[model samples]
Target chain A: MPYNVDAVFQIAGIGIIVAMIHTILKQMGKEDWAHWVTLIGFIIVLFMVAMLIRDLFQTIKNVFLFHS
Target chain B: MIQVVGLGVVATILILLVKEQKPMFAFLLATFVGIVIFLTVIGKITEILKVLAHLANQAKVNQFFLETILKIIGIAYIAEFGAQVTRDAGQGTIAAKIELAGKILIMVMAIPIIITIIETIINILP
Candidate 1:
């Protein structure tokens, strides 16, 4: 996939939104919800990064003639 | 090139803005941006390598040597990227280990060429 800045923006937006939710939930005395929100956000970003990393490794292997 | 720089700068600002509240996200953002930059330039690198390979073929250079050299370059690039990301995440020891591994792998990759050179010298002497 072509490199797009949209992923970066999406990740940053998620981070900001998650943080906001976490703060609001914690202030509401729902600490568990806050943690869950943060965890979900992190997982989403992790998946995105993992896919990108896989693409990168594939490209590197193809360019460098790495068969295994 | 300019687009890559602009993305980096924008990512940097976003990372800073997010860092105070979510350091993990900031780290992820850093990694994501790094990958994006690498991927963006990868096409150019591939084109350059293709041109280099064509030139080497024209020069009658050993294909084996060219392939090994390209592998070494790829390893170095990957290792550097890994080390930098780890360093950014504040894992100095892991970064150092990654670099050491890269160096060792490179040396291993060169051994065949080294042996060939020695054998060639021996044949020349006889």
Candidate 2:
């Protein structure tokens, strides 16, 4: 919960960076590279986000006691 | 919030630059960025879902209803995501089919809830 904002920043920053690289690659007529860049960026961000989701669910579990 | 906004603006600019030259890649880029943003906030979404689950439990709501609601939401999300992605890829027909599938799935999910509600009402009529 506390690091929620931090996670947002991290993921968004990655997204923007990926977007930038993607733009550059496209402008250079390297569509394939651009696509892979987007895919890789997505996977990296997804991994981090998956951790964040887990953390969030844990917090919710504590609050709601959904364990039982 | 600033970070999210900045990322959004940058992604928008990038998308604009890339769209015409490489429209297909641009769509994937957009989808990727969108998913990134969604992922960043997924924590909050889960929290809300858990809260709903808690409320359902406290109110002694039927498990069947809970499962059905979850499944319906899943179908809606999948359909919406698929349709949007296809539309972004310039495939309107595919998007339409995805939407139709989602609607059918929702109708199927609703049947049990409808029947249960009807049964509950009938029981109260006596």
The DockQ figures for the candidates are: 0.69, 0.10
- How well is each residue in B11-121 modelled by candidate 2, as lDDT tens digits? 777667656554544555566665556556656767788788889999999876876777676567667867987788789999999999999989998998999899999
Error of 2 at B106 (Å): 1.0
After TM-score superposition, what is the CA distance of residue B107 in candidate 2 from its true location, in Å? Answer: 1.0
Alpha carbon lDDT of each predicted model:
0.93, 0.68
* Sliding window of 10 residues with minimal summed lDDT for model 1 chain B: B1-10
Instruction: Give lDDT: candidate 1, residue B97.
Output: 100
Candidate 2 Cα errors over 4 Å, as ranges: A1-68
**In candidate 1, which residue ranges exceed 4 Å CA deviation?**
A66-68
TM-score against truth, every candidate: 0.95, 0.64
- Sequence-dependent TM-score of model 1: 0.95
| Model 2, span A19-59: residue lDDT tens | 78888999999999998988887777656645654554454
Of the true interface contacts, the fraction found in model 2 is 0.00
Point out the worst 10-residue segment of candidate 2 chain B by lDDT.
B20-29
